[model samples]
Target: MRKRNTLRQGFACPERSTMTVHDAVHARRTIRKFTREAVPEALVKAWIDGARLSPCSANQQPLKYKLLMGDAAAPLLPFLRWAVMIAPQLEPKPEELPPAFVVIAVDTAIRAAGAEIDVGIAAQTIALLAEEQGVASALLSLRSREVPVRDALHLPEQMMPALAIALGHSAMEAEAVPYEDTHKYRLDEDGKLLVPKRSLSEVLL
Candidate 1:
């Protein structure tokens, strides 16, 4: 299972197959600033449906998604910003802030490894679907180990929380661009995507 959740994983959209899931992957980014135009609840619902179709281990189907939209989402911003402060630079600019979020949590005790995997896969699904719907998203990792999100959301005790994906109507005049200089990108001598790779190849294999 992939340790980190990403907007990639080549999950194909077999039904339409029009945009090529790869386009979504390469185009997807953690959109922060968002337009003031609120996202319609209908669009959010579609994203959830898209996530529900994600493949699960043994089809355990252990994942669950609860959406917080409209007025129901206001209280979350304060604590959400607190968790986000750990990476202050990553904060969404005013233009990038999403109005609401589709909080993805899972009951891992039932499915174990599959629960984690399902949560991640579902996240990407929503991300892609958000782009398809002309909305934008940002994958906000839940922090503060002491605070249980399930309790905050009034979810069941068994449901272990995983991710909080903020979604909103967006106006992205700026394109997702690679760094102008490789120095900022942290690449390898071979121009591979490298991030502090080990001197001894890290794996000791």
Candidate 2:
């Protein structure tokens, strides 16, 4: 009798990959203190590619991305607010400024109802992808800076700036700390960035 061919049954084992999606997810931290080291353009493009494939509301994909670097990133710096929770101590210094930025704009011509959700997913996707590339990112809402950002970027009236993500090599460290009565994050005396997260029990209900 002929033996059954296991190869034809598609049972081949795959080689081990460097890092899993879960690794990238869990390792991701909001990095505000970035090194002066410039982020390669190719890495930024890869992050944007990942963001573009993120799940969208009704497949409308209403998000538009604008990549800024060098001089392009400087004009938008004043518009960005960092470490508002800790303000003076946690605010990034001149040398720690991010070397690149991506402005996620919402196209008003598309359905606007779910644009917020779309932007949220896309922004996180970009951040996570950046982590995989050994780059760091800070996702900024750009609320008060929206108008100025629009003017500086020369965004069309039809395009509304939803968020800005700062990216570069990180110069500082951030760690998740246990949650307490107040869920606000603060810096330690040593100046390490600390983030407070809700306890599992507090979130499950």
Candidate 3:
């Protein structure tokens, strides 16, 4: 019998050094401020590949993605509201705007009812994948500005813009803080984002 490569064989095992899904979930955070560095097309495609695999209701998948870069993404900034908790202070400055965006849309003609949940699943999947790729992201619901955004993207009658994900290298730090009295997330004096997270004990009940 021929000897096999132990390292290659063990790579698929969960005990390996590679980051696990759980690890990526914990490490993923909503980053508002991003560096000017652009996210490459290859990585964006890979992220979308992962998002496309997200579980959907009754397998009636109906999500669409529009990739925008640099100037293409700049127009979206005025429509997206970010870091509302800290408002202007934590908002992305002109120099710190994300270099790319992924506009998630729903094909209403397919299955319009449950598309919102699908959007969440796809957005979270992309965010997790982006985290693994050393990229940061912010998820925006573009609800109030949907009309204008839809016009700007020139979306077809059947396609409705649902979510917008800002992508780039992180320019600030965000950490999950223990949930105290308030559930609102805030920025510290050092401008670090403090996310409020409830303990497992409180949530398992």
Candidate 4:
């Protein structure tokens, strides 16, 4: 008999789908509700590899990732504000919280300023890779929550938490629809998230 893949045996490795880049882009959404199923730490780390290879400004590569899972991730939950547009309704319940997260931190010691572009690129890379692996993801900007996050992670003074990407198995479905008067997402009667997106024609010009 052939040897089995040990990584799959030890962790909840969801089979990678045959999702194209375009498909992943179209299917990707900000998932607020996630299943309690534990996300494999190794798998989440692998997504960081994708971000590692992302382009950085002047190759400074100031971005660093901090991985959190299960209990370690719980502390940061209270500080994180989810789905501000929908507030409490879209906030994940205790049972629906993401089991893992990749916090992107900026190493100010290296290149403090002008790292925003690199952060965006790296974040999107992680999100797309997670989506391809049948994992749900939500990219969260720390903003006012930065202090609590840094404190919770015990990050060094030189490292600042810029963004957080929550990862887990999705408990709900969300779809991007053509934009109407307002470009706000809403939940349908079935609890499915309806995200309004501008059409290519409207954006092309």
| Candidate 2: stretches off by over 4 Å | 1-17
Cand. 3 TM to true fold: 0.88
Instruction: Show model 1 residue runs off by greater than 4 Å.
Output: 1-18, 78-90, 93-96, 112-114, 145-147, 171-205
lDDT of 3 by residue, 10-105 (tens): 231111235567877898889988887767766677678889999998888899899898888866777787866678877877899888899998
For TM-score, the strongest prediction is 4
**TM-score between model 1 and native:** 0.68
Candidate 4 error regions (>4 Å) = 1-16, 143-146
> How many Å off is the CA of 182 in candidate 3?
0.4
Count clashing pairs, candidate 4: 0
Cα TM-score per model: 0.68, 0.86, 0.88, 0.91
Candidate 4 global Cα RMSD: 3.7
Poorest stretch of ten by lDDT in candidate 3: 1-10
lDDT tens digits, residue span 1-205, model 1: 1121123234332234355567777656556556778766655776788888888788778887878875676545554642233245445565556777887766666665546677788998999887765566877776631236677777788776677888876544334433334323232445232222233344568
Report RMSD (Å) for each prediction in the order shown. Answer: 9.0, 9.0, 6.6, 3.7
Whichever of 2 and 3 has more TM-score, that candidate is 3
Q: Which tens-of-lDDT digit does each residue in 1-205 have in candidate 4?
A: 1111125655534454667899889989999899988767877777798899999988889999989988888767766768888888998888998999888988999987778889899999999988887788999876543566788888888888888899998999999999998988999999999999999999996
State the local distance difference test value for candidate 4.
0.84
